[model samples]
Target chain A: MRRAVSALLALLIFAYLFGVLLKAPIPGDYRDERYNYYSPLSGREANESVPDHYVERGEEETGSQNIVTSIVVLYRGFDTLGEVTVLFTAATGVAFLLSTQRSKGEKEKKKEPNFMASTGVGLVLPFILLVGAYIFVHGHLTPGGGFPGGAVIATGFVLMLVAYPRFQLREKKVSVVEAFSGLAFAVIGLISLIMGLTFLENYLPKGVAGTLLSAGIIPLIYIAIGFKVGSELSAIVSHMKGGEE
Target chain B: MMANLPFIMVALFIAIGLYAVLFKTNLIKIVMGISIIESAVNLFLIAGGYVKGGIAPIYTSAPEGEEMVLPTPQALTLTAIVIGLATTALLLSFVVLIYRHYGSIDSRKIRGLRE
Candidate 1:
């Protein structure tokens, strides 16, 4: 009865908020030129809608066929850097927490690995890694990007953990990859600064948009993000597994 | 009214998540509530970026005249999702530590947190 009453109260609150939201003056359509023309970055006006601006000129500006990639890795690169740092910090925190020593008698009991599970994971592991690599590599031209690709790679690590309980990821190698990729991301931004552009400015040449090798620095940043996020998440999983002291 | 259906759904999700967070005693349920809230906010963001008849913001072979949904919100949502993942991991780690120290995950019984 108490649960029901609380739920009803929540529903009432939500209904009120929803009514307020509905009454809020959101534009019915966002196709207006005036709404799109304003650019805070350049303090200049464009005739096209905001998304249209990115869609129309983003390819030329960033040399990436995938406009979303251009937006994420090129335009808002600083925010992405902060996001990567947050993930890295969280992974490090988890590692620190799980590094606490366990009493010898309280050690987890080992379960026998199933033959079918191990064999199946072994069969699919290589393919999963391949797909992850493909996703990050083609991020500049495809729907996938560094974050999703890194998650896919971490999923492979998860599979290994599930199949072989004793399997441990080498912390040293993972940390090295994570550190270098993070440093490389920052270094690229520093290099752009050296070129007299603002931080994370695309100083590299904008090659052809549609080709695999195009999108000059966009792909490089995505590659760094991919490795960093993948290793960080994999390390998180390993920490959670608590196999290594 | 029909156009606001997605927003209504998002509100309902937020409401449910709030209920879970407010009334549930289990620490894990509170974490789950937090996740639900995060997802609801993400849905709200994506819905806010919707256009009347817009396609995706992708540029490869996009139709000549169709408007595209806002890409900025999608990017923001992606960032939020990543941050949410990190926070969730940290929260769960804290929960593990709590369970280890308190010997239970019940909110009422965890006296150390109440001082």
Candidate 2:
């Protein structure tokens, strides 16, 4: 009966998707001469007299070779904060779900797990850690960004836990990393206020574009995101395998 | 034909995943189905960002003002993959906990918890 119900639901979903595929409309932003293009209403342009140099300076103003990073970090920074909060909420939900059913006595057993799987994890974890960190640091200039890089880094712990069933992730390290990274993320945002901009606005010098050290708060935000995601995920994994407690 | 291959592949993967999630009796299989669905979504996203002849998106020693593959979707895919991994791990953990409590991994057998 459960299988049948699931099948019916699946069929419904297929029908919906099929219908959408058949009838999906072209997006309004398509550049076609025939279509009536909605133009943006003229708004108060920033006074050109104050500092015209900032407008002409494209990549140099952000240090990131990728314009997408600038749009995300500098232009739409407030959205990033909301994104972080969504992650935090998901973590909190996982914790709440897992903690409720944990048995009382399971908490007392803190013995270190056998090192059978630890040997293999110990061998490969450093490389994974290194790559994850590299991805986070070079996020602005490279293909990989903060969230993904952090996830890759977090997978190191996942690999360790899976390879060594007896080994548990050190809670102290996880907690410290999470706390500090989250703090740094907030601090970076707050500092934007100090720099005469709104929260998370770019406050640092927009060095030359395509340079390693460009994109004022972009790299910093990526690092913080990497750390935050890595610790949160590892903790989640541990909670999963933590079992009974 | 080749250009649309990725989209077709992603669609099929997602379809199979949805089937598995809906029809499989085991909770673990259902979770696997979800993961497969995530994989399909990620694949589609990455494919959407594909250029006819694009490099790995590194901006070094390239032609001036060259058109590059969209980076936004790649970034979005990374985020999706992370979210999928976290959710999958959590779901699997729940399955494990349920198995411990009921000694059965079958979803129907564990319906006792509902009442």
The TM-scores of all predictions, comma-separated, are: 0.92, 0.76
Give a tens-digit lDDT track for model 1, residues A66-171.
7788889988999999999999999989988877744346568778788999999999999999999999989888788899999999999999999987788999
Where model 2 places Cα greater than 4 Å from the true spot, the runs are A1-61, A103-120, A162-166, A243-245, B49-51, B54-57, B113-115
By DockQ, the best candidate is: 1
What docking tier does model 2 reach?
acceptable
The candidates' interface RMSDs, in order, read 2.2, 6.1
**Model 2 over residues A29-71: C-alpha lDDT tens digits?**
1112233333344243432321122222335656676545554
| Cα distance off (Å), candidate 1, residue A31 | 3.5
Q: Chain A TM-score of each model, in the order shown?
A: 0.88, 0.76
Whole-model lDDT per candidate: 0.85, 0.69
Each candidate's root-mean-square deviation in Å?
2.8, 5.8
Best by TM-score: 1
Q: What is the lDDT of residue B23 in candidate 1?
A: 83
